[model samples]
Target: MSDLPPENVQQYPRPPRIEPVPHLVVVRLGGETIAETTGAFRVLETHHAPSYYLPPEDVRARLDPVAGGSFCEWKGRARYFDVSAGGQRAPRAAWSYDAPSARFADLAGYLAFYAGLMEACFVGSERVIPQDGDFYGGWVTRNLTGRIKGARGTEHW
Candidate 1:
């Protein structure tokens, strides 16, 4: 509803693309503010909702490194984090790439949160919907078009 054009995830790039999010991004949980920033990046991939990444300096919650690790071809190796705020804990609810691929070098040390694990996440003034399923961490907001990944039948997508 803002002045931005609608994002069609189906048409997103295969290797993923990063772009600056010019809106205010905020993460809140258990009545406490987890992270807030006007400076954030959105990663868009095919058949997926955009994932917003915030800088470490903007995160106000506690992030404890966890054991699980994963590798993304475009983003490189990722490490998990257990986020704690307002006395509530969500295990491995966030992740960051300590060293990213050259294409995503700007994402180094940037934290991306699971909207489903938070009380609420906001992009600009709109509250976001968490993408379905447990396999993907995407934030769904208004003005996004096309079929999104992380849904029940989207496992292979």
Candidate 2:
């Protein structure tokens, strides 16, 4: 738990809100820093953990294009990236919506990582917890509260 006040994920907007994150975001894999950024964006949706998106220039590791992709109604088609560093590789560990919807245009060219696939992911001084489930890339920090989605019983949420 954190000393900060709790923020319920349920309070986030339905369509999701994309906003700039003032804190530092970092990602590590294979004992190497793959991505680090002081300027990043966060996607907050109701009952879901906030997904931090880092700018392309901020990523320090190599990102190789992966075959196949996914679709998001709000963010448009998504492409996957395989992160490689320090002789370690995490396939499809990152994703980006090159041409996002109008509401999420700011996310274009930005990348979001999966905490479970990386050695570590951080927001400020806090290490993040991967949202439950393999498909969702939500990041859970100490400041968040409420029953988050992505768990077994939350399939309908």
Please give, for residues 67-140, the per-residue lDDT of candidate 2 as tens digits: 99999878899999999998999999999999999999999999999999999999888889999998899999
Tens-place lDDT per residue, model 1, 10-97, is 8999889999999989999879888999889999999888999999999999899999799887798999999998989999999999
In terms of TM-score, how similar is model 1 to the real structure? 0.95
Query: Which residue pairs show collisions in model 2?
Result: none
Off by over 4 Å in 1: 1-4
Which pairs clash in the backbone of model 1?
none
What C-alpha lDDT does candidate 1 achieve relative to the native structure? 0.91
CA lDDT of each candidate?
Answer: 0.91, 0.91
Per-candidate clash tally: 0, 0
Predicted structure 2: lDDT: 0.91
